[model samples]
Target: MFSCSTMMHIPTSQFLKLSKFKPIPDPRCKTKVATLSMGCFWGPDSLFGSIKGIMRTKVGYTGGSEPDLPTYKSIGDYIESIELYYDPSKITYLDLLQVFWNNHDSTDKSSYRQYISAIHFHDKEQEQQARDSMKKMEETKSNSIQTLLMPYKTFYDAENYHQKYILRKYKIFLESLCLNDDEIKNTYAACVLNGYLGGHISETEKVRILDIGLSDEQLRYLEACL
Candidate 1:
């Protein structure tokens, strides 16, 4: 829960400059990448971004035979996927895989290739883990899972508008952040706020965010946005 006392002191004008409040990882911190497709990338982008350890999230098209670049309007044979950058010390790949399986209907078949469930593993280790996890899921259901396990390949970024779907709806918040196109797509603050707006953030996560040195005015703005 947000602390009411923390919401009463700082000036509102200070909160309007949100870039100052954006979280930045330590320069020496190590991060890992994970990419997967479980249908529309919008939901998963917000879902994964809500997790504490994720550094950034981006939605794109991948796992296709098309030679040209893919966009939402002309996706070709590609799948709608999201790529995640996370702090390994705080979250493991196995943790992300569990979240993936729990949130999407991996066992059901999709007529559209773009919406099919798949995991694009970045390395051999990830591939093995994904396969092992899938095997367990298959055993649990006593039926084969439809999700595909594929090696990492090209990930053509989606158009800017599709990047942070839910968060983009709040124009005032975006204006406050004063972010350009690239910043909006990759910034940590945008990632966290997107999850909050999508209703994926938990009370514990809310407290975690509040403890990140935000001023009183910023806390008020965030709670209001929520």
Candidate 2:
């Protein structure tokens, strides 16, 4: 049965055929990591990439016992989560939490745990802040907060098809990055482009894109895709 929240509606045969490209390295890796589960991972994955200070984002599975079996069809026991790498100096964990609550139905409970809203905190500060944010959110709404706030244990990267889904729709934009399938799934530049292609990009984000080492022709192609 297809869950209303799942985005795996396309037949396997109809999936986009993407080409393999060479790797273009991103030097920046000093950033804080935050993970969240807010229904479908694809939506949140695209959403956070748009925000300033968010360096990179990846869709994965967590909050389950059997981490090995987290395929879309078998992820019933796991929560679909987006792991974010962000610069705390630019964007705080609380700020991301604010976006989390705003972007999805935090008060609504999912029939399956996989799509449930959650904040997978990584540290004591994050834990305290996440709980505080939940309380603050609860005070603002009539409905009870149903989001799961817990310490992050393990995160299993989702399948390749699940990575940069929105950006993948614009195959040309992806090819511009010059990344192979494996590298594309984890590239910081890809994350920014994913958000832009997903419709959450800002002017500042566009400038950032221009500065990320893409050639003039590639930039034109990416702009066209947008």
Candidate 3:
């Protein structure tokens, strides 16, 4: 049995073995990117990590001044944001916007810029789709959505601790992958693990990872997650 903390959906164990694991190939062709700021970055990062089309997810600072290397404490005018690389063939940008709006309280009245909600569009098409979605949402509801539709800007990655907040809790699981901090950021395996931590891993996704050359032990661990 997993501990109370890790019993969210998967069993947990401290045992780790470094076996020969195949690198998850990046199968995306002409991927599109999306950026969003909806309260804390951790949840959004994990949330998107679970989606089918997501190739990579990163939490960072954006939409503010003082781009001089933002630390959590020194994030001058920046708000928390998530940068996502996704395949449009598998999931549409509009599909992501739906998930974004559903995950956040767009009507949030918080005065803190860090907690404010916004979507950074990569191009006019995304901007238009966002606006259309916002309008459609308002058509049936009374509360005004406060999510800002802004143009794309710079994204400064947050500290390592904040990158995969949920999955990082299981140090052994990460150690099994033998990935350095930088490697985890770019790895699709990390993305899948992060998503699994967030209860967003689908059965199809689970099966895919099982074939990624994980050891029997690691495969069992992931199986328990499913």
Pairs that collide in candidate 2 are none
lDDT value, candidate 1, whole model: 0.79
User: Each candidate: RMSD to true structure?
Assistant: 7.3, 4.3, 4.2
lDDT string for model 1 (91-146, tens) is 99999999999988887788889889999999999999999999888877755789
Which residue ranges in model 3 land beyond 4 Å of their true spot? 1-12, 16-20
RMSD of 1: 7.3
- lDDT of predicted model 2: 0.76
Poorest lDDT segment (10 consecutive residues) of candidate 3: 1-10
Off by over 4 Å in 2: 1-29
Steric clashes per prediction: 0, 0, 0
| Candidate 2, residue 46: lDDT | 77
* Tens digit of per-residue lDDT, candidate 3, span 98-184: 998787778776577776788898889999999999998877667887778888888899899888777787667777778789867
* CA lDDT, candidate 1, residue 180: 86
Point out the higher-scoring one by lDDT: 2 or 3: 3
